[model samples]
Target: MDNNNQTLATNELATLPLGHNWYQKVASNFEIIQSYLNKLDTDEPEANNLKNKFDNMSDKLNIYETNIQAIVNILSDYDVPIAIVDGKVVEIKEGD
Candidate 1:
């Protein structure tokens, strides 16, 4: 049983998904948002509020993406299944 499990893990590792360039696309989008925010009048009542909100959201996104990348890196180094479905990790058994 242990040998079979090891073989199954090896096969699954061989099928790991390739990395996507989604980070580049997301960075480009953030640049566009920053440009729009820069065009706003600094003295406007809502300008500061909008800028603060945008900054907060940008920080959160950075943290989220960084964490996700780290998780992927660690997972790729092990025998765990990298399959994620609907925000849940899917584990495969020997016969499944």
Candidate 2:
């Protein structure tokens, strides 16, 4: 998408009322980001500067994905209602 059409989570993701759905969306984004980062790890030199950037970004992303997975686990454990709108989490009805 063009820069103007990009999904700005700080705006749309935050203002919306999605719950577990957001977790799934975030998980998807994290996957895409991780894949690119992995490619960079192999394609680029192992110099300290490049390594540091990849390490920091990848580590933080892993933490974020872990958190998202935790929410997914919770929702699954309870069989909560889940609605993913436009590939993003838009609703989650608990215990339903």
Candidate 3:
């Protein structure tokens, strides 16, 4: 994935679901959500309602956070997801 890191466009931010699928393999969960919507038949109002809410999840959910004086970097091309910060990577390490 590192090879493609140079190619990940910064113009737009990639989004994960509300929570459960935040860190799933290759956006499989996200694809699942989209696949359902793609098949939505407007004839079915109930399906449309469900699709509507799911579509708005990105904005409704806490997708991004900001802390004072922080360097924000986006993770990509991964099965799962995370925001590495506080001068540490792969979780917090006590000391050297």
Candidate 4:
């Protein structure tokens, strides 16, 4: 490839965040919760109440996931290198 293309690719790579495991873990937990909720038989009164609670929880989780993704996208657009450091989102500098 030409030097220009190489530089562009490098810049893009530099902007990309280093960590995704945190997001993946959150997504996995959401999946697990949904899976368990799906297995419940909501015909019984107690089960129905529990199902309603789970449904609400699922909705909140979905909203949270959406917001997280939006933030990630915004950061990516601005070429910010974000990562989970000490249980917080931190910027990673080049060569650090």
The best candidate in terms of lDDT: 2
**lDDT, residue 87, model 3:** 39
lDDT of each: 0.61, 0.65, 0.45, 0.63
Q: On a 0 to 100 scale, what is the lDDT of residue 34 in model 1?
A: 59
lDDT of 2 by residue, 1-86 (tens): 12333343444567656554777666656666666677768776667777899999999998987776677668767766654446
- The alpha-carbon deviation from the true structure for residue 4 of candidate 2, after best TM-score superposition, in angstroms, is 36
- Higher TM-score: candidate 2 or 4? 4
Clashes of each: 0, 1, 1, 0
Candidate 1's TM-score: 0.39
lDDT of 1 by residue, 1-96 (tens): 112222222344445555855555555556665555565554576877789999999999989867876786688579665644565556655455
Best by TM-score: 4
TM-score of each: 0.39, 0.35, 0.25, 0.42
**Candidate 2: lDDT over CA atoms?**
0.65
Question: What is the alpha-carbon RMSD of candidate 1 to the true structure?
Answer: 27.9
How far out, in Å, is residue 47 in model 2?
4.1
lDDT of 3: 0.45
Off by over 4 Å in 4: 1-43, 83-96
Clashing pairs in 4: none
Pairs that collide, model 3: 24-79
